[model samples]
Target chain A: AQSVTQPDIHITVSEGASLELRCNYSYGATPYLFWYVQSPGQGLQLLLKYFSGDTLVQGIKGFEAEFKRSQSSFNLRKPSVHWSDAAEYFCALPSGAGSYQLTFGKGTKLSVIP
Target chain B: EAGVTQFPSHSVIEKGQTVTLRCDPISGHDNLYWYRRVMGKEIKFLLHFVKESKQDESGMPNNRFLAERTGGTYSTLKVQPAELEDSGVYFCASSPLPSGLAGVLSSYEQYFGPGTRLTVT
Candidate 1:
């Protein structure tokens, strides 16, 4: 079965600092990847996704992710962090070929410090 | 436009009790999915429904769980004699069916609801 791994369980970054959350997947082929964010009292919101084409993909809230096929990683990055950006981040991929169900990582909890 | 909505934002019940969670998907969405996240674990898929039909239910944990979507507009998930292990955040999401060729796969975004938090004492 395909699975996603988020190496960081929690991270703290100062406001205005750059941020990057790592995600790795184990699959036979290049699979579609996604990053989702969950605010304190909100539902999961999609940050971005990588299907095919350019390795870099941009998403909502000024977030971007780079898909590195060699590393089996699709890491989420932001040039500068904001206090509002603190939340739990999840990395996900399809359950299987042609399946819409998603398999997610354990997630990384991000905290912003002023 | 309204996003996916779930009823009973939070529920607390004793073991051996029953509880039902409801979800209302976005208007005109054909695909609905259920997922659960146990405390400290990854969110896992529970099932998928395609217009009142169960497309895939391989993720359902066991027989104690029942899900129904009679008219395809709203869905209900019931847990009979809920167990302590059933405590988790249950999420419902919806998306439109692929629009391209029948067999080809197209990427469609899934909009999620605010999730129902279940706690079994």
Candidate 2:
């Protein structure tokens, strides 16, 4: 089974500071990796996804993630984050065939401090 | 175009009661999926439907959970005799084409719904 792991459970960053959320995955074959964000009591919104080519994939809201096959990781980054960026970030693996589900991480809660 | 739509944004029911959650996928999408997130846990796969057919339902927790997509346009997930463990957010997703095993084996994206939160008290 494919799985995604987000090492950071909680992260606090000063407003306008850089942000990086680490993600690791375990899969027999190369997996489809993604980053999603969810506000409190809200539905998830896709931040970005890495399919093929371009080791670094850019996503909505100034979010970007780099896929490193050597390390089996896809870490999300933002040059400078805003207060609006504060939310729960999830790293996910795509489940195969049946349902084509996106296996999510426990999620990293991002807190932006002013 | 409208995004995925899910009904009853929040539902609170007593344990052992019944609850049904509905999802309307984006128009023209052929693939629809159901996933659940138990509190503090990873979002787990529930089932997948391809034009009213169950492609894979391997992740369904147990017999208590039932999901149906009668017309292949909309879907419903019913939890009967709900248990405390069933409390969590249920998400629906759809894609123009079924993101087959090859897609996962290769790469593709799945659009998501807002999610229906369920509380079994």
Best by TM-score: 1
Model 2 chain B worst lDDT window (10 residues): B98-107
Give the alpha carbon lDDT tens digit for every residue of A3-105 in model 2.
7889899999999999999999987776778898998766788888877789999999999999999999999999998999999999997765333568888
lDDT of 1 by residue, B78-117 (tens): 9998999999999999988877673234335778999999
Query: Whose lDDT is greatest here?
Result: 1
Every candidate's fraction of true contacts kept comes to 0.74, 0.71
- Residue B18's lDDT within candidate 2 is 99
* Candidate 2 displacement at residue B97 in angstroms: 1.2
Residue B32's lDDT in candidate 2: 89
State residue A53's C-alpha deviation in candidate 2, in Å: 1.0
Residue B39 local lDDT, model 1:
100
Model 2 Cα displacement at B2 (Å)?
A: 0.9
Clashes of each: 0, 0
